[model samples]
Target: MNRWLARLLDTRVPALPLALFRIGFSVVMIIEIEQMYRFRRLLFDPMPYVIESTIPSGPLLLIWLAAVLFLLAGYRTRLAAVVHYVMAVIVLGFGALPHGEDWQGDSLILTLSLLLLFMPSDRVLSVERLMERRRRAREKVKDPGPVDVRLIHTVFLYLTIGLMYLDSAFFKLSSPMYLSGLGVWAPSTLPINAYHNVSWLMSQEWLVRPLGYALLAFESLFLFLYPVRRLRLPLLAVGALFHLGVMFVFPIPVISLLVLALYLGLVPAGAYERFTRLWRARAVSLTVYYDRLCPLCRQTVAVLDALDLRGAVAWKPLQDHAAEEPQLAAIPEEELLHDIYAVDRQGRIHKGVDTYAAVLRTSGWLAPLGWLLGVWPVHPVAQRIYGAVAEKRAREGGCRDGVCSLARPGAPAAEPAPHRGPGRLARPAAGVLLTAWLLSFVLIVPAGPLLRTYVTGDGALANRLENTAEYYKSRVYPWTGWTSHGVFMDEHFVNYRVQTMLVFEREGREPLRLPTIRPDGYTGSYNSGRLWELWTFETVKPELPLDQVERNMSRFVTYWAVRNGIPLEEGRILILQRPMDVTLDRFRRDRLADNLSQPWKEVGAITGSPGQLKVSFTGEPGNQSGLYGPRS
Candidate 1:
């Protein structure tokens, strides 16, 4: 029994699986973080976009990363493993029931990896245990051979994971929505839609159903096929392929990858050792420059340098070299030390914002953030802001010493009352007002689909008849609940456009008269062929049309139409069609074509059924002249 137990159990290989799991989990988390940053969105703004939880993902990421570092160091292994499990569970739980989505395949794997980490396998390869062993050896204590208990734990963990796969498969098969392709699962389908890759996937019928079924089978029957030791690796390889396929289709979270790593087992021990030997052999020196006098500056530099793994930066005391370096010497000794300073590999000197960028680029941690900072408007604006602060610091003189001296009368005080200027306040105030207006629009607008209008056929004949009331009845509004009347028409021959004005009041109430619009507020106005008035959506105050103003007006009308569910085709008809071409159907052509030779007396009832309207339309044109006819 002892020999059998020895053959079945081994402690030396435990870290391999854990390492794989750790690496995979880190990758997934990083990818998710990057994706969020790329979209410039928080968790709640986009679909499958959930409201960010109270526990911010950023802090949680730091916690998980700290656990990884602890595990790598092999320090307090048992405690680290336990903490790792707890953290993984909390993150995975949120992912599994992500506020907007269901258990994405990625979430399932993450949850499994957390479960696997709880196994006693750590007793074999833990750094804590190794340290303890070394301490015992130094004391000349006899070495214990192996821990069988840890082997047992590994076996149990593996079995538990295999069982989880089975459970996932079972649930997937049982899900009615999944079976019907209803896309209600949230994560899977929603991501597909977001990427705009749904059409391609859906078009491939052979791939879709089979891919779904394969995922189902892989999870459901994993253990049944690979329960024993020999088949485990191969089965897991297949499982890895399944996960890889999923990753290709959808950007999954890091936790899923980490869990998959566990299933794949760890790297060969020899390979790990070889890699570590090379890594250890390489020398990395990091130099960080911090002001020795300022406690705050010193602390920040210390934290940053500590986080730097590559040792690319070397910290130098700014005051020590202030007299030596030309750039440093150019700045007063105190001023140079007051602001942050860092140098890169190329012997280039950087200060303040530039230095921060250099350090971030060196760390390879802030590439995305740096890129955003480098973008126009952001870059220039940030540069100006940083410059102002630096100038202010220079004027104040040695804020680094934690003492302040007020600006002197002759020192050209840094933009006295900086906050009071139009340069600062005007832009921000305008931004605030614009933001408020947009927010109001978003909030007040109905969530329902926008109004749509469609126009077909050449518009030439419709425009010529002008003031006839029947001309306005044909436009479509998706949000229109009741009858609509078209009142205003502004014709432009140069642009070949006809502007139709439709005022929608409550269904029962008549629209207010044009005269009631108040002349004080209405400065720029034009007559509408004795029938109505034409007011450009923009500036009743402008009283003139500049190219830029017209362009802006065009944009406003387009955006309004789109948000209100007005179709592009309809908007174009209203904006670009000639006045004569704007009619639904010409009165003189359709009605009087065959009867042109005869006197144009009252028409006889010629019965051809007009189409039944899907949505209600009140066929009333403005009291003025216009024509609204067939949609085409």
Candidate 2:
């Protein structure tokens, strides 16, 4: 077991996975911060009516922004990760007090960034790496790539994501609403959905049922299949498509995009490597060295062979007499294990992202894409993305005969996986850390509809290990009820079912209106068209007391009046709510064609009886109105 474990860690791969992930995650953190800043008045208002926060929003935001900048620059990165997570806890945990904000995306970012803290993310184009290069002492004892450290990071990453999604699937299976697909159908048909214009396509039962089942499968099955190499890319591709559909079809905010960004790490670097080699039908200007035994590469070779109309490139499998190839002889064998090497016409060597792009340029249609990838600014990111894919491909390629064992191109193939050194992560202390992580993983073990069917329940260890770890999150964690519960619910409330159109008027002048809620402050009035979140938070809340919705709206107008200098107590605020019977049927029949038709006719205030319904606010604060959580 000891030897087997060592070999597993010794498997050759690149540092690019963690390094590239660090870059993408930092960008996401920046965007979250920017969005919050853009809608400060709406999101961060400190009035008693707003959700109470544990810490000062200003300082927490400043600290978050500072940490994000350092993290993006890869300066003191581990420190940044620590700071980043600390802020997440403060904001998402405590700041989301009373009732939680949608915290799934924030939780994911926090967890992933926390994993980076344990890995060497500062090894790439980082300030720390550059500083190390300047020190003569550091140059003497160079560190071998920390493949073990990389594996540890990967373990933690999968462990976190797997637990979350698997539990989601479990909760989904437990929900009856999800079984019939009404959970998804309800939300997609709502006005809030950005793609409502085309969302009617899912009205087909065949499409909706399969889609519901697909989400359950994607979230649950991916956890098990993620570690398999041949199946890895395909799974990630499907996952990306799933998230893309979610992004447009629902109003789930930025979580889907964050998941898509993380999936960037799953794309193989050599995706274009050997495949483009066979496209050459003319004189060969470039020679590509690849493993002919690799199933993935062989398929690519066949496709390229079929596609090759002009012989412009040569794809050569690394034969026993690899050294006999003139230019290949000079290249080191160990590096070849991690990358597919390419030799140009003038004996110029190309590998990694550059090699794939160079060879791909031969195809007329793909030439533009290749050129774009090779450009200086774009190539850096492209290189890392390719490295992420290639490293995984090479790791899973497996040793063929003894040929893959050779450390140099000319040397005889004699080994399996290469073990270069006693890397830092292989130390006893590192072993202890890994052991602790694995032990804790048990508490969050997998068991859901997918797992229970085959692995547990009536299967092997049914009683010994719980089939699912739902109790801890679904019940134990208070906030998680809000944060995580909606995975497979058969029905999501259509927020637009009761839309409120607020038209405010001063004593003498016309009720002022603008395109939408201006970020600056309240104009005279706004329609219910684009104020989905704001209006829904305040008025569409049915669970609240009839007076509770009024209090919430009044607080908003009070704040708005403060910002825009309006005497709110003397003004009239007209409220109109769209009923479900009228709106839902109209939506099904018209499919957004009659979107401009107001639901006010069905539920709006009586047009002629202005004085019948007169409600007044004293501008005095009482109990804060609860919007996100009416039950609380």
lDDT of 2 at 121: 65
- Candidate 2 lDDT over residue span 420-498, tens digit each: 5557756564466556545444544443343454455565565434534545434323322213424424333522343
* TM-scores for the candidates: 0.34, 0.59
TM-score of 1: 0.34
Q: Which 10-residue window of candidate 2 scores lowest in summed lDDT?
A: 602-611
In candidate 2 the C-alpha lDDT for residue 31 amounts to 77
Q: Which one wins on lDDT?
A: 2
Q: Per-residue alpha-carbon lDDT of model 1 for 19-125, expressed as tens digits? A: 44444544554454343333211232211122234555655656666665676555665566566556655554434213212223333434444443544444444
> RMSD in angstroms, candidate 1?
25.2
lDDT at position 265, candidate 2: 51
Model 1, position 369, has a per-residue lDDT of 67
